[model samples]
Target: MSGVDLGVFARCFPAQAPEPLGRAIADAGFSSVQLNLSAIGLPTIPDAQALADIDLVAVRRDLEAPGLRIWGLSGSYNLAHPDQERAREQTEDAARLIRRAPELGVVAVTLCTGSRNPDDMWRAHPDNDTAEAWADLLRNLGPLFDAAEEADVFLAVEPEPGNVISGTDAAVRLLDELGERASRIGFILDPANLVGETGPDEYETVLRDAFDRLGSRAICVHAKDVVTWDERIAGAAGLDFDLVRALHAALPHPVPVVVQDADPANLAAVRALVLGDA
Candidate 1:
């Protein structure tokens, strides 16, 4: 079980407080964790926590009984909301996350591509393709990417099923648009996020292509077991861990993976399985 001090998605444990969340990672023998700021009502920019020094002194002292580390902090919000107000708020929030990135020892912050509808962060829409919608996403992210560069860390934009950059191709396109500046905005490739309910053949082909394009940009991935599309809303099967890890291992660059969709009750088991404990 050796990989980037791998950790679980703390947001999976919705019941725990921040301290307990950190403690859970420690108890699982994980060296680090990826905090989901949106899940816990913590925005990255201009938030109260960003304005003041994060009181992680308590977490630092209490969460570690033996050994533990905060690899990075995350504020995964919709950066491309169709509503100007929502986009403004979320874009501003990115700064708050960046402010805390230094103390958290994070080299990058994770983010979502964002939904087309301001009121719906996870729903798919047709207009997400509109130039205006894309412009909105770019208008905000451009500054944040620069800020992340200044922070000396990368801002990883993750592809989601219902967002502007839903698949790897778009992610690649976005990177191409950035040119050399793409180095500032990295990637958090979650295959499941890009995948829809598709046949195994389709899934494999799509995922392989996705990785081929963005593998070099990946800082991390979200490991999850998902069913194929034909299996209904929650059907299909999980890609073999050995296969998943093998795909990641074959990446041009190295990256750690957080099991984003795992259940909290089975963190240790799932973590070990994903990274190949044997």
Candidate 2:
């Protein structure tokens, strides 16, 4: 599935609304899409209420494109939140997608474990390492995993650097906490998310090591690249096709390597790259 059927978020294109975005994604030559579930209507799915607001037209198009059904939702919630009420709200948002996952015809729900900053969903916080942080994460994610189990789908946790479970180690700990249910909850590998000085080349080791430990739980991948900077690597402004090529070469197949992160202007380029036309 890795790069075999490249799909991008229609919203990433930004030129059109939700419906056209799917068409653009299809035109890009991706056979499947890891839908930014939020783009469909729900901002974040942490429950069923958000699912009710989803736009069905986009789903129809994706189905019509004859695109292979991959991840049908992106419920990127910050599971490791500091405030209890805010955390529950986010989870409730994410859960909406989980409730409706079956209808989407996909089994996995991708999510960001979330950072501590309430105002900034993308920024990381220092308390993300404290025991209280861990407790909050466990409390939130434990139930999310429970919901996933009930939904009969897998929850793919993206290890974003700014989020709580930012690496393989953190992910492993979550798995240990959940035990057998961990099988239902897995990692959605994003190589560039770990970017720092050495970036993926450095984190490539992390990726491989993570694969060694959690290969079984690796449900999908986020095909992207990060730019190496002074003493650390940050997410690159542009896409890196080689990153997908390298990851595809290194990992086992059957799981999809979604062609994500394409901007609206270059979405076509991502399609070309994924389909081997580039």
Reference-based TM-score of each model: 0.84, 0.81
Which has the greatest TM-score? Answer: 1
Model 1, position 252, has a per-residue lDDT of: 84
- Model 1's alpha-carbon lDDT is 0.68
- Each prediction's RMSD over C-alphas, in Å, is 3.7, 4.3
Model 2 poorest 10 in a row by lDDT = 227-236
Candidate lDDT (C-alpha), each: 0.68, 0.64
Regions of model 2 farther than 4 Å from truth: 1-3, 15-19, 46-50, 53-70, 197-203, 228-246, 271-278
**Cα lDDT tens digits for candidate 2, 1-278:** 23354455434555434455566666666666776644554454524544565655456555445444545577776676667797887776666567667766676877777778876656788978778888887777766776787788888787777778877788888888877777777677776674433443465576567666766677776665563221112233433446455655656655666755566556555445544455
C-alpha lDDT of residue 132 in model 1: 78
lDDT of 2 at 217: 70
